[model samples]
Target: MSQGVSPAAARGLKYRALRALFRHFGRMRPAARLRLGRWLGALAYRCVRPRVKVARRNLELCFPQMSEARREALLREHFHALAQSVVDRGVLWYAPPEKVREMVALSGYEHLQRQLDAGQSCILLAPHFIGLDAAASRLTMQCPSGATMYAPQSDPAVDAIVREGRTRFNDVHLVSRRDGVRSLLRHIRAARPIYYLPDMDLGRKGAVFVPFFGVPAATMPSTAQIARTWQLPVLPVLSHWDAATGRYHIEVLPPLEDFPGEQDAEAATARLNALLEQWVLRMPAQYYWVHRRFKTRPAGQPKLY
Candidate 1:
């Protein structure tokens, strides 16, 4: 017979167990691991009813014209994509650099390189997507140096893993979200390409209510402000997993010309939303729909989960 462990000790043991499982899964073949991940996602779909509901509600709000059956199918696919991305974190963190490189195919990277080569500052406007971490990993390998912000995870163990995996490939300046935009600007002014995720509701502080999928969404206007203030070029970067090929694709599109030249921050933010809308439509299931995008509603408007 064994003595029962204390609650804190039990929690620590559980975390270690999960970490070991991730390492084991990371050693498996890519195809096999992804298949297992999809299965896990299916299990999560059945068990995590609250998150499933959130995904369904997001779909309903964003794609109002979509039929119930169609929306449900999209939600199921989204969960599977989300699961695969989450589980693949192990491979991204522990697998060899060559192995990680093999799993991604990049395109339009020259668009970014050209700007960097000319000694011009540029911002990679990356929206929230399921395969974002994979994309970031691949990016750190190819780019010389860069900067990005992250909201720190509550669990110290998990946070450490995330930081190590992201910065392992290249010399990246990881700024904490708590430090605010001032820290990010210092790096940007130093000619570091900032991988900015500009499409989220962080309340009304520095954000403006803009039309996202035809609904009023609180969006950050910092992208436009930064571009105008520093005369930096804005390039849109999108990443998605190709189910048919079982690989991730990262695309760096051409820079937006004449952006934020005479327009105010609010107008620039609206334009940013329109660009993100196009990308979301291209791969509806791969976008990060589980997030509460419409969490902060306009005053006098009812809240949306």
Candidate 2:
């Protein structure tokens, strides 16, 4: 017997039906996802021109001395890279571990090993990059005990798909941001090691506004707090995908041995932000520009958003 569907349920069914139609079209063959992604990337670059224009404006604002043509080139490159990242999600979710491994070229695994060997946990902070998802999946496979944060999705079906891919490497514990302070602190105390995205504006509560790329970008304070409170080593980790070399370089910066003790909390956060800025500047196109990074303006200022 079929259950009667409510009006809301019927509407949801219609929406899902449309979404599934597209998904079926985009994911027909085994390689369809990859092919569709490349096509979508190119299409997005052509049709959605405003986003790229804004990115150009951002680059110009940040680098005033650069010529207009150079900024346009950066904008085009950034849009294409971002589109590739979007399309790559299909591969990240469905590709086999062996296939995924070939795409990344990791450089620093020794720092992570040293921390674990000492019976201590470390936080791996990686910003937005193409190889980031691959690195996280790879890390979990290599380090079973390692845990990372997961942002719950609005769509239950998509959430399930994401969770399945992320956890397939190993049973990497996925902590929810809703757990507030307790969840992260608990993981640190147990030496279970967690990964987090430290960049972006997460608001004033869990974050402290700091100078990122010479502009104020809100940064998560959880990393520094846990490191100081639990006395855990803070390792700055970034995975860069070099197209020229056709490999991924995962670098682990030296542990922030002199953190927060000599300075205030905000200052320590600023130091980390500075380091992240350097990494992003190295590969500007890889960084996420869609993020309204300067949205949360200071109290007396006008809203940028």
Candidate 3:
């Protein structure tokens, strides 16, 4: 959910309870907090079955070649990662900045630094992962400034918390999805790297049908357009929460060579989707599967979700 509460989701209860829970959770030592997170994760796994059902269908569509038994196992592991990520947010949101930096282990940061050092704007192609917020929030600790796209939450309290968490450090610009690409360009022009996520199913406006895990999913093609417009390089970044060690691993990969091809959105969109597939293979359980990725069907096709 990227800290954004969906319209249909249960609201006041979650944020209010977590607000009180995190107050104490933030005070606990890392090891102890993680232990409690795992316990809460177990409880969430048992309680949030409806969302689990959505994730299950997503797995069935993406990994049909894998055995059903294996998918079930992966599903269980995913919930554990999901719940652990939420619990760790107490540190991301309320704990000291030093603790936040300590908990996040970022690799390939030099790639981003190299670009910024050379006075070039870079775009971080971040796919949907449970540890995404952990990675993004941590990046702001070291980055001078940056901007990212997000769908605003419906509830005021939830939106305030999420906005505060993201902008706590670096005064990073938080552009609403309704604000469009112009706001992003302004940030890039100011030398702030745009943290871009193009994997979600946002319907047919600026998106095209692309093979995400071999399924024709509606995906935004704007990554290429934006890169081409600004003459910037597109580098991929992926993050995952390790439940065992209670640490977030953020990998900022090098740029995709010859990106923003002549076909631009179409070809570039396909390449991005292909990259997401490869990343999903590495951390299958860590990918965000609850989203209705293939919600936008082509001309006459029925919905997959």
Q: What is the lDDT of residue 14 in candidate 3?
A: 67
Deviation (Å) of 62 in candidate 1: 0.8
- Separately for all candidates shown, the number of backbone clashes (residues 3 or more apart, or on different chains) is 0, 1, 0
Query: Cα deviation of 171 in candidate 2 (Å)?
Result: 2.0
Instruction: lDDT for model 2, please.
Output: 0.66
Local error of candidate 2 at residue 196 (angstroms): 1.4
Quote each prediction's TM-score.
0.93, 0.82, 0.91
Task: Rank the candidate models, highest lDDT first.
Answer: 1, 3, 2
Q: What TM-score number comes out for model 3?
A: 0.91
Report residue 252 deviation for candidate 3 (angstroms). 1.1
- Candidate that beats the other on TM-score, 1 or 2, i.e. the better one: 1
| Per-residue lDDT of model 1, residues 36-125, tens digit only | 878988998899998898889989999999999999999889889999888787777778778788887788989989977887778898
Query: Model 3: clashing residue pairs?
Result: none
